[model samples]
Target: MSEAARQAWPTVRSIPVSAVTDAKPPGRLRPARLEQVAGSSGTGRDTTGGGTATGVGTAGAKPSAGSASSAGSASSGTHARANPAAELGFSGDPGQHGDAGDGMLHAQRAWDATLATNRLDNLGVNAERQRLVIKDVTAAVGLLVDGWPADVRACVQSVIDHTDVSVLALDLGNLDGAGDVLDDLAARYPDRVAVWRVAERPHWRGGTATWGESRAKLLRLDESDVHVLMETSIVLRGDGLTPLVAAVAEGAVAAGWRGVDPADGREAGPGRVPALTGDLMAVRRSAALSALPEDANYGRNADLELSLGLRGELVVPQGALPVERLGTHDVQADYRERESQRNYDGVLRMLSAS
Candidate 1:
């Protein structure tokens, strides 16, 4: 071989054959321990550019499928709960978004939901705002103000301040001067509030104004894509309508704040219930008119019947609302008991078939 060739192929710093044979692969890479937190839950797996996670566990031990803690953590006397939102760089408080004139509450809730669903990085603020535009939604707040005149003003003002949706109201006999209040509000915001004064009073008060009938009238009168069935008792502290509007736009037949499901042939709580509460519910106007019962004099079980009659998805954005349900204490016990039985009978019939 030439001198250049010899220089190019210098002798190797030879390693032993036994050394190569005995060499072992690096120990299996240790999986990261995801510190789980209580008081909240998350859905879907999270992925980043770093590497795959084999499993979830604690720092010093493995995690079980049903339990968040390991044997060691049981006696640790301290816990390091992981905030999935904070961990993913969304470290700001949702409450500090804004004060008013914008859907800050809606934004905060959306951010939280994004975090819970492991989609924080994907959905941006602009996307959420787009959903809040809600040009196709209108609110139907009934003026059954038998007494609380202050509630009427607050309710109307809250709707006007929080959302861009137009309002339609039926002032039944101007009970407790509520019709005059609605008229004043309509005058103040002429383009926003629409009022219909009726001579009859609410059915519960023994007059001609029926709950289902009035709701059906509003549904018919509304030209918007969605019609919100809200009571003046529902005083919103934030832009609650946006979430319901968003849900309806996203294919839900109807959406509401509180909901009830049949439990042992009666209404109960705490689940993604089928029947939306009348305090605040938004339904497709056409669908509502179609399903609304003509004979339903009071508002009692009509929500359940309407929900059951619908052929599409029903949802409730429970935690996302900052709403105050008022006027519940104003309901008369005798009237409540009688109407409740009538409503319960309908609810039972629906439950039996399902």
Candidate 2:
């Protein structure tokens, strides 16, 4: 922000990181915070406080269970209500507009009354037009669990956080208790997560479990129409997988977050592409079962090999998905380098024929 803009903005005291604690999955996060006055606690607890950190609110005071039940009842009757926004804390009344205490607007933007009375209604507004959520098309994310070094816990949690689909995680010899982590997540989200444990080690990590074999196993295990191939290194910012699955529903054999056209020697895109990257690719489980290279021991160009094998459209949707790559996994450099080159050679042959 510019100096002027910085000056205009109110100083944000503290920001909540994540409510979900790593140690405690799906636990109610504690909220007591802030120190103001000499030995004054914002949380109403008797504690000595020192510092200029002002009390934002008594967040420590949780709502009563009875109140929560009442709120739930009110929510259940939402469809019958004419003014549901009132229940959701939205108010057209100017007096109800939030302020910085004693009737001061937080920002000049608030003073304009644009947002205070602004109508941003979207409850069933575009329900019919949005093609991304076509009816009856089930989807699930398929990820390999080679070891704990791949951030399995965080990756599974991220998938659970961002998408509504079930996760079919294939655990190949839970290298370093990685399979245990999958078991924990499966227990935590029994309805949303499933794990297949194999005693064989991963071929890429110097194990017998080959990439093609495990990927094909995942394909066979998953019954969803759209099966996503996501590496643990990939993190999503939002429902990034939805659009890819939507593209599949729209009649594409495969749709990935990124694409490559080896024929043209460049990245390809929002339409038909020769191949795709496997970092975050979604495919039809039916097609993927037969197309995935069973002998490949690594991903690298294996994804592209699968892409080329598919007969229909391979799409890279327009605009960026809310996803971030956390680089490649902590695999052996020599193994990855050699395997990647080998896979590329195979892709080269496929490219020549096409």
Distance from true position, residue 91, model 1, in Å? Answer: 32
Instruction: List the candidate 2 regions with Cα displacement exceeding 4 Å.
Output: 1-132
| Span of 10 residues, lowest total lDDT, candidate 2 | 8-17
Q: Write the per-residue lDDT of candidate 1 for residues 1-354, one digit (tens) a residue.
A: 233321211111111112221132112211111221111001112233122221111111333432322323453447774543332234457754343333434444444454444343134442364354454344444333444677888898999998777887766666687867877888799898877666667777767666776666666556666678877778889877776766565455677787677454444322134577677887766667668765676777777777777656566542346798766635677887887778768777877887
- As a whole number from 0 to 100, the lDDT of residue 198 in candidate 2 is 65
- Per-model TM-score, in order, reads 0.64, 0.63
Which tens-of-lDDT digit does each residue in 299-325 have in candidate 2?
888888998988676766654678987
Per-candidate total of colliding backbone pairs:
0, 1
Candidate 1 ranges beyond 4 A from true positions: 1-147, 264-272
lDDT of each: 0.57, 0.64
Q: State how far residue 272 of model 1 sits from its true place (Å).
A: 4.2
Error of 2 at 311 (Å): 0.6
RMSD of candidate 1 to the truth, in angstroms, is: 28.1
Q: After superposition, how far is residue 160 of candidate 1 from its true place, in Å?
A: 0.4
